[model samples]
Target: MKYKAERDCKTYLDTGRLFAPSSKSCHVGLNQVGSLPLEVRSWTCSNCKIKHDRNVNSAIIIGDEGLGLLALGTSTYCP
Candidate 1:
């Protein structure tokens, strides 16, 4: 995974704009600002009011970033 991440960060000659399709607005994280010891493993987005798991959100962000980079044409694939 680390190797893939590093590879994605590289710059590509094509320079085509890349964007990650995300549903982040639907899961804007918990609204409890100072609350500690979160009772649930998941929370609803204040903006869209959609429920989301902490782990799932993290994975989405990471995958989005990777895909964003890939779309930029910085892929390390030597084909």
Candidate 2:
């Protein structure tokens, strides 16, 4: 999934220093630095007040995991 700040003045916040593993699904993980809490399905940034998409964020995490070395090298198919 692609992340695009709603406004040109706004920028994405990165919270993760490195790859973060998924707590539930092996095929999912988060790569972006700063992210919203799991309890928060959606939120407006304190600074920008722009609505954030939770599904988009989760999709990005899963996409990152899919591109990882292990996922790409594994013969097991994932869909």
Candidate 3:
């Protein structure tokens, strides 16, 4: 069974990058890898210079992916 975290990580990897929650143009690639093990829930984007919550960031990505699928006429559901 695939967990949401696995899907979220896959989404990030396939996109080849991550963006700041506050500044969509700001890239934060693999910079937070070390922070995850420490159970870091939030961080400041170097480019955006704004803090972002981990849960919020993941929700945004997942929401966007769902919207993309909806626009493509794909069902956003699992059995």
Candidate 3, residues 1-79, lDDT tens digits: the string is 2366456543212322353332222223423333343276776766557676776766666566556666776543433
> Top model by lDDT, which number?
1
lDDT of 1 at 4: 63
Query: Over the stretch 13-76, how does candidate 2's per-residue lDDT look in tens digits?
Result: 3425354433212222223326446775654444444454665655555556556635545433
Per-model RMSD to reference? 8.3, 14.7, 8.8
**Clash pairs, model 1 backbone:** none
Runs off by more than 4 Å, candidate 3: 1-35, 76-79
- TM-scores for every predicted model: 0.50, 0.32, 0.48
Worst lDDT window (10 residues) for model 3?
22-31
Weakest ten-residue segment in model 1 by summed lDDT: 14-23
In model 1, the runs with Cα more than 4 Å from the true position are: 2-40
Error of 3 at 20 (Å): 15
TM-score leader: 1
Q: What lDDT is reached at residue 65 by model 1? A: 65
